[model samples]
Target: MKPDKSRSGCPDPSTNALQWGIKVKSSNFLVIESDASRAQAIVSALSFLGYRPVLADRVDADETGEQWRGAFVGTVEDEAQLEQFLASLGRNARNLPMLVAADSPVATSLIADDARSQLIELIDLPLRYERLAEAMRSLQTRVEPIAASRRFVGQSGPMQRVNALIRQVAPFDSSVLVLGESGSGKELVARTIHDCSPRRDKPFVAINCGAIPAELLESELFGHEKGAFTGAISTRKGRFEMAEGGTLFLDEIGDMSLPMQVKLLRVLQERVFERVGGNRAQRCDVRIIAATHRNLEEFIERGSFREDLFYRLSVFPLEMPSLRQRLEDLPALIGEFNQRLVQRGLSRVRFAPSAMNALRQHGWPGNVRELSNLVERMAILMPHGEVRGMDLPEKYRGALPIEEVTGAALIAMMEEQPMIADSFAYGEGDPSVLPLEGLDLKDHLAGIEIGLIRQALNSANGVVAHAAKLLRVQRTTLVEKLRKYGLSETVQAG
Candidate 1:
């Protein structure tokens, strides 16, 4: 339990604090160590570093409140104790900086898999003050905020307007109805609103109304007492109770049946709901944030959705733009996806100019989710390479006409006069050739050939064999032509 002096340098914590320019006087740190001697040593180090250390055998969520700056859990032996300790801290402390000292594999695995260890500093056993100081500094850096809007990507006009609306409404507890296509980040918007709101410290629970069955949806939204139904074994608190003083996101709210909608409307109006098979009514204190892809107005017209409920939910309506509406954000989104891929141990990839253009032209019916799926697919297919025009799917490639021009005819035309390529429009209004003063047949034909090859390759999505078929040429012949024009670098053979 005592500090191993053989491995201790015992550097002055005050000097480290001075170097960091940290004016730590009453800054509290909770140290959870079962061993008294080791705990004392940690407490002494924290005190020397200008921090007040509170030594405890366990973490008490209600006891610490927001008083403790960070925590140091030394040699966790019991999983149940750790889980309970972390659960007590609730969602607010999920990001709290923690340094866990462990020597056993079981402890290491437990911490690694636990969501509560998100901001874990280290798992090095026999804690050292030097590493502890580093973690403290790092955690302090994370405490600073750049901007709330930076949490979301996209600087498009539509997105800018959405961000503005979010900033304006986030401070209040008014009901918000987020309208967007599927995969358009409705849940993200709800979370952002909650994060920017006064109830950020409380839990933000989410449930998909459409995902759960009508028979169980009522019980899911409202708590069910033991023996409320056939499967009700114990008293369980629903999403409303779980959310408590925070926010409850009802995604796909339009899909909630008429009976469920009526119940939800009552809760919204009266701010109270009773559990299944229970007479006691629970007050609803959480803010409501609902999202849906379905048009509730149309649903109302069809007598499927309640008009009163729609009005109740649409107090502060927010519409999320589709991916097609925000094409300008594609590059930034791609960059973010690449960074994510790299983090996942996948090779980062880039789209060629033509490939990007094709993506921009695409009609993204599924919105951002579709784009993200495409990016993930491309990452897997072309893990360590560039995505060229030929790398796109066949459906994404626009139609290109087959131009039949012989090399000899092109050379003859060029030889006759220097071609002014800019002045003459190819395959435009007039089918008959225009009288030109100058024509560069070689350059014109080469450019035409390159353009055709690129278009074919794009239609084939970088598949050399398929592109060859599209161009009505042999694979070897296309390969030779590609090499001759230095276009082989743009093509990936499947």
Candidate 2:
């Protein structure tokens, strides 16, 4: 396949090595580095090679007009800074593949092993101009051009309806409320709307309301002036200012505290907000796209979420269906995830018929997000080979072949029991029917623990070590439970 060219002008790889300098014209290659000198050097080299390079401590490429061709993220030698650097990169590096240049081999090796697959491409220090150029070229090809994602995955009836809704609402500037359970890919739906809308060329910023603490939430949403609070050493633009002309996706909006809700409601109503500690009201031209797993109507009734705010946000409500509600799409989703994994350098892997049948049987309470995580886990955690029914976690082993799980019934199943223990506890027992609801806290906790371990295992694709990390428990703890649960037979030696 011909390599895709980024909106940034492609670098002339055949240029002479001696003329290394930076050329940041109309907006081409973006350079993000901690060392000002190295950044200058890299930029100079790119300029010599007939490519434009812009230098900035950070590049919110989504906000600017230029599509980034590649990035130079510097990982500091200090262990403390390394994590912060990696975390920053983790959040922003999804779109552009990054080349991480570190001062020490140890730091470089750690980043390479951990984050190389996900986003960063690690390169040891004492930088070579040619090597950096090659890395940039390779990355430029990987990033599918940031155009309207013609890449809709699911073809089930619900998804078709979703597509129809997107088409209907794409042209307008109405507030959108995306309702769905966790992991249902509500953000993807939001992106589709933004992509198809008149604001396609503008920024699309997403914030999880629950993720930010209430104390800092105001500044994050509305921005704050320098020295506004204890840690506000410098003025920082809020997500609203950053996403001035595009869409602002407020995820998990139901979790916002009452005070925050009132503030957000004011913004929605007036289309203006004053920066924290600032007297002037700034006008914001951004479109509001909010999503939540909670029932906002119930929250409104309970006086948790504001009624006026909910109405303003829900002007164009779009309900995202859970995975089971769209079971027919599982096959397509699996194929898409598989393709993505392979493209990201994973060995080609496929689910065995029995394994796939098992997948279809389980309640995907986590929705498509859960299913996608499961699929990725299966891809990487499977023993470098085909994933058979026996490869599946215990929860999905034999209830029904994966194929039978579909539609609204599947939705009911997922909603009822999010995991294996939930299934067993809810489904059946010994000689007579048993009531799990009346069970003691220990049994309830155990049931939930087992379910979480199994889900973590599925997320790790049964890799004990990786599964432990997902569970945030020791490897031994996970292994002991695997044995205690009589899951040893399914544990592949990793």
Candidate 3:
């Protein structure tokens, strides 16, 4: 028999009469209906509620192929047909939240018998649009975190901690101060915070406090009116104004001068500031996220930084761990870099076990930035090649021994020499035979000093502190000598 095409109210199983119904829209649902009139009515109701509904003649006949967050299936004919439809959906039917409208109590009981029916919300005969809408809203909230976790790529403990902190503070509108060594990814943390925050839809403005000149920093932060200064030919909006409702990331905040800190403090305290030459104060709703490599506490002790501003900016502090501290993540980092290189039309490279071990042992003072640079360099040098330990630079490979002529060894050599007095017979013969070509005494002495310093460094296993201890000199003095002699790289190589 042909199903009724006219849209009609769902018939109550007990009353056999039409009942009142509510319409819902745009909730992207996959709908399967065996009754034409029921399908039309369901489609109309979902369309009115701002939802996209895909109508299917049978559960197994769904042609949309697209994954829907919610599903509504109507009028199951028998247990076998229902089982066939669930089998067609496979894993999705089990995991996806679904609302099923059964035409009879027998059909509902059969559908509930299936293992996949745990997530199914069953309504007999008359459809409950209110119940269906509520189910969809709950499902949407549960799917959000699955999507959010895809943005970050590390599984290390440090990265996990960072992710936890980002999730914790992203909902709040407090100032955050990120601390880390240079190139340790403080900016990435700041960006992640902004991406997950309530103000994500707004702009994110970043400014480097250390890169800008002190004289112009005020104008950059608070903006400038027309004719404010020699170069202020037109009105300009500063970072704070540009960021407005979003985030303003102040990179290298420790480099900001004392005067600028005072001005920033006022802005933070009052949440308003005036243009350089304008009298009207503009209100700001920006969230401040500051990052720096310098020790602000030491700066405060030195009277170069304001303590109150520090407290204000550091309401919630986050420290990015250096790459050295997360060495276990090196393989993943290398793979990511290699994939990036491939995307740029470069051949990918792999690191052998030995090479990876060598990299792990080296000190990465420049952190991730240094590792990235080395990876790029290696990719260019040996495209599509497996890098062995020997392929790495000398500094990363291993330490070299230091060669030196000690005073004791020198004394032993002198004792081995024949007595000069016996060979020179008082003043009759030359006291010592002179070289035909004259040598610069100063140059000779300098060469000896350089050799001794090199030997000391080598003997100390290239540690500046240990070398200084051996030479009975301050580490700073030894460092200066190393720099003067251009042996800094040698020490690093060790």
Candidate 4:
């Protein structure tokens, strides 16, 4: 069969991708040509070079900026249409590198002059591999850093605020202090800022102030000359020197000794530090991003931490919300962990809705790190399986902020309340059957108990003791459970 030809007499654009073999070194780009034949031609070019290209039509269906690395535009579009397309990308995508494939000077002249600065190049078309490859290399340089921040995941309100703060401060050379509980992803936040900042290509050096001995920490941050100490056989560069033009992440900053804090405060003020046992001052050009689980104010009040140092490190403060606080992001976090596990040669495991409820109920004192560990464990235990409530570990099976209880506790409670169990559900369908999403045993048991209590109370005219007798439980136990659930406030003990 003959191939479809455009009005301009060009061969079918769809078949052009096979013209060049796919290779690995290119990027995913948006094929921004509005003309159907032209869009297909752009796609074919991208796919040929191992580049994933999304056509202009796909942009209308899903406008997310994350999937696109850059764009390839056709100058054939009117100036108005081009402006509208760029505007549709929104502020998050405003910095995207764009390329225009023009057939002639007339087409190139149609693009706005200011817009020309934003484009990587306005190369003559017919999609030459060498030219397109170089353009993509430039595009990848910017896209890779933007892609790094994608790992710092969360769509929850708390995470949005954190993300907004990161965007606001990342462009400027400002000291950032991250305050959060241990295992709350403080390092991840610091790394994200560096990745998204102007110094993204530079090295990101991290050191734990508390992990190093007080005597060694000074040399660690400011470097040391040869023979400065017993172990200093050769000159060594500290984190600050190594980081140079990038970021230096000082983890557990609050734990630095008072003397060490004084030394650090001087470096922040002067932007210079001398190597240990060397009088020569070294310049400090790196941005500092410090984090600590400890409260700096409390340490200052206790006279353990320097108040001056606290103010210097906190030009911008970021607080990471605990996993329990952002329960809505839990599923996404689990899915991320599951994908990571898959990469590590383990089959994925999914959580049923009822199982998810149980996981959400957990207080998550260890935060995101703890949740990651749990996901890995689940994948190891039940590879490629959908985990239900009962399948969860005892600890994660159930726990509320107000009350801590596990699957074992729920079972014990049910056994102790034999009479209540007998009347439970009143033979409502098959008790053994689980819903499509499964069931949270703790919540399911609580619902049945509460329903039976309400029935007993109604039957006994809302008298606590009478209701207790009807349910075959001690009056005191019934009263306590009623208060625990906040079911009723006014009821006679009799």
lDDT of each: 0.72, 0.68, 0.69, 0.72
TM-score of each: 0.62, 0.64, 0.52, 0.56
lDDT of 1 by residue, 1-494 (tens): 96654356544433344223234344367666667666666766766566666554434334545455677777544543443354455553434566666653235633543223345666564556687677777655444321221267789999999999999999999999999999888988998999899988777767888878899888878978889999777676777886778899999999999999999999999999999989999898999999999999999999999999999999999999999999999998888766666655677778877778778888889888788778888899998788765567766644311122233443354346433332231322332343465434555456556656877888999999999999899999999887655567788975
Q: Give me candidate 1's TM-score against the actual structure.
A: 0.62
Ranking, TM-score, top scorer first: 2, 1, 4, 3
Candidate 1: deviation at residue 121, Å?
A: 18
Question: Worst 10-residue stretch by lDDT in candidate 4?
Answer: 18-27
Q: What is the lDDT of candidate 1?
A: 0.72
Residue pairs with backbone overlap in model 1: 390-461, 390-462, 391-461, 414-441, 417-439, 418-438, 418-439, 419-438, 419-439, 419-440
Which window of 10 residues has the lowest lDDT sum in candidate 1? 399-408
lDDT of 4 by residue, 1-494 (tens): 66445543454444554223233123246666756665666676676566666654445423454445677778433433554454444433344677777563224433433213433566666777788878877665545433442367779999999989999999999999999998888988887898799887565767888888999999878988889999776666676876777788999998899889999999999999999979998888999999999989998899998888899999999999888788999878877776666555677888887788898788899998898888878888998778877678888877432233333454466568664455453545555667677665765667577667878888888899899999999998998787666556646558
Q: Candidate 3's residue-wise lDDT over 155-227, tens digit each? A: 8999899999999999999999999999888877887898799887566667889988999999878888889
For model 1, the stretches where C-alpha displacement exceeds 4 angstroms are: 1-57, 60-150, 399-494
lDDT of 2 by residue, 428-455 (tens): 3431334665544444444555556767
Q: What is candidate 3's local distance difference test score?
A: 0.69
Question: Judged by TM-score, which candidate is best?
Answer: 2
Which stretches of candidate 2 lie above 4 Å from their native place?
1-28, 32-37, 44-68, 72-150, 400-494
